[model samples]
Target: MNSIVTLNDTNCPITTSLAIAEGVGNPHASVIKVIRQNIADFEEFGNIGFEIQNSISGAGRPTEYAILNEQQSALLLTYFRNNDTVKAFKKALIKAFFEMRDELNKRQAPAENLSRMDILQLAMQSEEERLRLEQEKLKLEHQIEEEAPRVAFAKQVEAAPDAISVAQAAKVIGTGQRRLFAFLRQIGWISRRNEPYQTKIESGYLDVKLGSWDHPDHGLKQSVTALVTGKGLSKLQKLWSERDQDHAA
Candidate 1:
């Protein structure tokens, strides 16, 4: 798992409203509502940045979410009723923000000692690195454009009945079904029999459903079909993306 907080483009440590919702086990809209209701109080710490992200659902609608700095995020927590889950998330979030800020501080520590020529050299190096990043960004944007059709299809084929079969998940993830099953098995998320491990089930990443089919002459046969929940699907997507990055590297 990654840190719950992240550094934003402005080099500020921030956490999103969505992450807060997921961590606190509250609906995203409810979290957004709280932010909106208490906007003035939060702004007292700093100006909150509101942005829109496209929905991954079939509707393809955009939703508004807020980005909050450490103080604002900590303050927002006071509006929620205290609970074990909320308290735990708050602790984790605060730790993450502290760690990120410490990292930023460490990165800036060498600036005071730089000579004029060292600063000039660093500026040139930074420009070269920025150009390289721009090229990579363009490539990434092109890749996203190419995958738009598949992503659209995935949204249309939403996971149903609270979960989806491995085959269905493969379609949503834009991978071959057999390949996905193999990957899952190799990662120990599933068994050789293609069933999710008991631990994964407990983690709410997967589930099992009893299924039956008519046998040729022996009558009916029963089987357990391993299923992937929405959470599991997102996890798999992230893992697959990391795997691709590793392969590319």
Candidate 2:
């Protein structure tokens, strides 16, 4: 059997509803039901308390699972009226989680020290080299700004397309694909495996056109892309600008 609690690469202790059920000797379905009933409580605790994630089953079907952090795990355990064995497990779990967290912090201390030393070394660099590096960094920033579609199309409202792919939108918005997708999900613009930017179109936030294209692998795909209209472009420009402003603030 897999360990009920495992530390992620980042040293964060994480467990799932399944693991919690197993650890506490409860039915997984019962555990899931209780969590759903108290979903608001979990959400109030934010991402650290609980996160919904999709996983593949042994039968190759997708399943949704709740990934719980240590705090969430402890809270969940409290919901169950358990015997001595489960109570002991709960106590042990909490203790182990904190111990692991402390161990990780200790392990990271040397790396932090090395980072400080590196920063001091950089501070001692020759003035000319430092100036050159600063100039290069600024040049790179300028290039990135220039290349971003949002920056280029901000003033031209009439030239926007009807429907754009998530990849294209991310490029235009000057955000990573994954980051943009996550943001869109958070805003309820899209869900798992749903069309990108569809909610925006449905909500009249933007207009879109469905189109097909020849695929390099599959012969041809239909409705595989959405072209953003001129109006959509304007909306996107405003949204992206506001996002940038928020980040700057």
RMSD of each: 16.2, 15.2
Point out where model 2 deviates above 4 Å.
8-10, 48-57, 60-62, 111-249
Q: How much does candidate 1 score in TM-score?
A: 0.46
What's the distance in Å from true for residue 247, model 1?
64
Q: Compared with the true structure, what per-residue lDDT tens digits does model 2 show for residues 1-249?
A: 126676643446777898777778888768877887787787676563332222335343223357787778878888999898688788778777777777666645554566776756645653555577679657755643333321222112232345566667778877777876676666555545444343355445433334468889997765423244445556666877887799999
Candidate 1, residue 228: Cα displacement in angstroms equals 48
* Structural similarity to truth (TM-score) of each candidate: 0.46, 0.41
When summed lDDT is taken over every stretch of 10 residues in candidate 2, the lowest stretch is 148-157
* Off by more than 4 A, model 1: 57-60, 111-249
lDDT tens digits, residue span 148-178, model 1: 3223222121223678999999999899999
